[model samples]
Target: MSKQASAAIWLWLAVAVFVLDIATKQLAEMLLVYAQPVEILPVLNFTLLYNPGAAFSFLADQSGWQRWFFTAIKLAVSIMLIVWITRLPRTLLWLPAALALILGGALGNLFDRVLFGHVIDFISVHWQNAYFPAFNLADSAISIGAVMMVVDVIRETWHDWRQRR
Candidate 1:
């Protein structure tokens, strides 16, 4: 595909994912009470929580400095990703798409952080009573996209190595 077409596709995908993420988060906020856990299965649950910090609640207990810090970081990262995506090679659609997913997800959470001082998380999973932290669709998409990008990179490296041998 042409570079313009590739960039356009990634841009559209990012917008779609961002919209879905925001809609789902809105639904969670409307339907669930803060920190109220609702079991979906033996190993899965929904529990609303607001994260004011980065992943795993980093700096969650800080005296508010972390909030703006994370917000600024996310904003910078989102802008950088957009620029990087535009310059990406047309054949590396997977990498750009992955970056777009991460960008969209980051923006989704950043919106919450800016508007509500935290991120809205609701989906939860556990084993027995050992509960995993609550998360949302955007986080899942980012994680999946990152994993795929890593896989793609590893495969490409291996291919290059074989060709060089």
Candidate 2:
């Protein structure tokens, strides 16, 4: 496919993911309202939580400065990803799409932090007595994007190595 077409595909994928992430978060905020955790199954639950820090509640207990710091960092990362996506080769569709998803997810969470002082998280999973912290669609997108980028890198490296032999 042409470079323009590939970029368009990535752009659309990002838009779809962003819309889904924002909609789910809004639903969580409106319906959950800091509600008590609701168990969906033996290993899954839904709980409303607001995060003012980065992943795993990094800097969650710090003074107010960390909120702005994380917001700024997310904005910077989003900008960098957009620029990098534009420069990506047409054949690197998978990698560029992954980056776009990560960028969109970052922007979504950043928007919440800047506008609401925290990110809405509602999905929770656990194993017996052990529980994972609640998360939202935006976080999931970022995690998936990161994993896809790693796979893309490994595949590209292996292809290049084979070509050089």
Candidate 3:
């Protein structure tokens, strides 16, 4: 396949993830109140929240500098991830999927940070009185992508080991 076609297949997946993330954020905005959570399950809740900093509220107390910094970082990382995706053969299923997911999620939050100066987060998980940080679909995508990357690495290592043996 042509490079464009190859990129297209993966990029389309990224676009889908990006679009879905935005749509879900919009739905959360309309259906939920900011920081006021509605329980969707015993351990999960839908809540609208914004994060001005990096993951886990890192540097949130900074004097408005973190937003641009993070936006730049995400853009740089996104470019690298896209390049990684395009370089991979489509025969490598999980690797490309993982990279596309990370790229899509990065762009999704990049849009929010650039346009709105923060990310819209809604999904919340908790146990009893303990609460995990609220996150959105973009975050979920990124997390899953990271996990898939680990799986790919493990698989590759195992294959190499077997070949050597």
Candidate of highest TM-score: 3
As a TM-score, model 1 comes out at: 0.93
Relative to the true structure, how large is the alpha-carbon lDDT of every model? 0.85, 0.84, 0.89
Per-residue lDDT tens digits of candidate 3, residues 1-165? 356435436878789999999999999988888888898899999989999998878887889899999999999999898777777666667889888898899999999999999999999999999999888899999999999999999999999999999
- Each model's TM-score? 0.93, 0.91, 0.94
Measured over all alpha carbons after superposition, the RMSD of each candidate to the real structure, in angstroms, is 2.1, 2.3, 1.9
Off by over 4 Å in 3: 1-8
Between prediction 1 and prediction 3, which has the larger lDDT?
3
Best by lDDT: 3
For candidate 2, the 10 contiguous residues with the lowest summed lDDT are 1-10
Off by over 4 Å in 2: 1-8
Pairs with steric clashes in candidate 3: none
As for candidate 2, its clashing pairs are none
